[model samples]
Target chain A: MSHGVHDTAQARFAPGARVRVKPGRPERIAPMHLRTPHYVRGREGVVARALGRFPNPEDLAFGRPGEPRILYHVEFDQPPVWGEGEVGDTVLIEIFEHWLEEA
Target chain B: MAGTPLPESVELLDKLVAALKRRGVLVEEDIARCQTQAERAQPETGARMVARAWLDPEFRALMLRDGTAAAEAFGVAMAGAPPLGVLEDTDRLHHLVVCTLCSCYPRAVIGYPPHWYKSAAYRARAVREPRAVLAEFGTVLPAGVQVRVVDSTADYRWMVLPTRPAGTEGWSEEQLAAIVTRDCLVGVTLPVAENARIAA
Candidate 1:
């Protein structure tokens, strides 16, 4: 196991894995280290493109050069995301592959 | 701004400003300058690079790849600006920029970041809930395009090079730069009016 920055994070990779946020509660099993912005979280969108092999930010920020992980560009609907009657705009985030699963 | 910070040393600075204001040692205009309006003089080098890139695509790629290097390619010396990065907007991904901590902006390209860039509302909301933030800016993306909120922190500052709007193919570089407003380049708003200056 590469001692990268994301080493402390649990469940490095698995699609459609049941995941839940710790929600300031440390005891719960948090499947993915969530990087999805609070706005688009839970708002469903398809995976547009998977950008592979990028340094995990948890490591990159601290200068820990660990193994590269898969990154995905996740897209969400504008209306569904912002709610109805709002100007429609899709939201996309660059998330590590480990954070996602078969929804 | 990301370097080691000594405690809240800024409290001392603020107290000094308040004292000066009480004594009428400084005028409102002076305070404005020291507060915000007194940013580093706009780097002419960056302005010229923006104008040049409006005319050339090869230069555009270079700007995206090595931001500082590309600026110098057009004789724009990036002396005062902090290390800068260019984030390009594409058909699938739309970029919205913010500096959550302090205003770490790409002075080499679009000049000082707007006031909204540093507002607490913008900072707290941008990274937390991007969809709501973009709505505040009045930019509704197409049904399929995804909005990616890139935070410009102390170490890495970002500038959004908006996709060149259509209907300006035959326009000159000078004409194009006129449309590239500071807000547009920052990705807070879209470039409008083929040849008109972006409304401040």
Candidate 2:
């Protein structure tokens, strides 16, 4: 396992943490190669697992040495995302630490 | 008759491969070996692994603990492949896989991903409206069963070990393996005994 540029201690969130995706416009973040999806912005989910620290892909796309960021497997209730039509479903999205805030 | 022309993208890929070989970034023989390995590592390999896990408790534990190692033990070549994670589905919880960023899949184990798995609509709706997507795939779960959609967004590639369907008891490993389809491994559908009958 190749540890990227940072350590686990620098990680912002841990497993089981309740987090909300930070809402932002893609244009405001960068002009090209954004890793965080648009639909997930502003959605709330719990951290299912900590996927360890890795190079921030957003920076890596530009051939820069991306500073490592903690990634989490965030699980969201289906009803909240897609409404009552999907009451029994849950969706898990892998998100970086930068895009998350305490719920 | 003249052979059909290759797609522009494929032509470009061939050029890129030649360029890489010239630059010493890739070796032709190594690429050939990897291609052979990929061909051997088909969806049937994944199905076999699922069947073995269904039959042997120790293998199941090992599979859950370290998927890549378990795959290697079964002679599945995983060289230059992303790490594998096997999600076991129980009666209460189910699993689904998507690559929200791109079409990242466990190609080494399950071969090439289906076209739908690589579609933009799937990537968008799978997270936003998974139940609807699964419904379109003809996999309707009960109200009590919780669907867990896994995004293969990082270095880890995920596959589901769907719960063995009922009425498969006393069946041989090969018999059980017949029912485990690529969709079942991906969690889009469940393995039915009747499907096994048709396949057999």
Candidate 3:
């Protein structure tokens, strides 16, 4: 399925980078199945933070593969994104390392 | 006998919301909280963060690092009745939120979304091409700034707190909030002032 971010270079993820979940407390709940928003998956984003890991949402959402990966905060710019007429300069989103790659 | 035809969607949605509450997906207290905030809530944390970033390079970096935490530092509660997630607006990526299935939302933080937000036209078309969709809503953006679309599903909800508007060399938080219209918070419109279209 086409995920839909026009300028892939604007993302922070490396084309093929293996990142792990660095877990934490209530702040870092892991092994959870979650429906990672479509706009954020497989996009290149900088490793903004190493927020400790917990149950990943994918597992928690569907009740399968409960293994949690290190979560990283990723930020994206607006101009290159929506293709003209945006308010802010950048957008920030949280995602696991498994979702990143070199653009 | 009184004769009246109610908009089926409104009546149905109200009933569905009630049913969701009855089924424990949401509670009376949750509904009450959403109401109170919807009537009066504004994006204090987002505005303050943008303002501080405008003045401080470091805080902007922090905002980029952890939006929820950065918002919390400014005294905005990161957690809400329903979990809240931050969706930033970038140059290329525009953000719009919708819930076709239900009004799954981060009610505690940004407050209840407007009635139009959950509409089918918004939900379907927004995912197709958000910029065009926003334009239809009269939220014409400047030369730059891309639009990214966000879907509010049963599992997670989203909100877009537009960046601080221009003008007002120095405006108080309350004054700033005044200009931060409901449209701005939802990413449907931009908050403009000063040379930024003189919204006042």
Model 2's interface RMSD: 3.0
lDDT for model 2: 0.82
Give candidate 2 misplaced runs (Cα > 4 Å). A1-12, A26-29, B1-7, B21-27
Sliding window of 10 residues with minimal summed lDDT for model 1 chain B: B37-46
Candidate 2 per-residue C-alpha lDDT over B1-200 given as tens digits, one digit per residue, 9 for 90 to 100 = 12466799789999999999999998989989977866776788889999999999999998887788878987876666766778999989989899888998888679978888998898877777777888898999866888888877776788899999999999999998899999888888999899976876
- Listed models, DockQ each: 0.13, 0.54, 0.08
TM-score of each: 0.54, 0.86, 0.53
Chain B TM-score against the true chain B, each candidate: 0.70, 0.90, 0.61
- B85 in model 2: Cα distance from truth in Å? 1.3
Better of 1 and 3 by lDDT: 1
All candidates in order of DockQ, best leading = 2, 1, 3
Candidate 3: what lDDT?
A: 0.54
For every candidate in turn, the CA RMSD to the true structure comes to 9.5, 3.6, 10.0
Global fold similarity of model 3 (TM-score) = 0.53
Q: B196 in model 2: Cα distance from truth in Å? A: 2.1
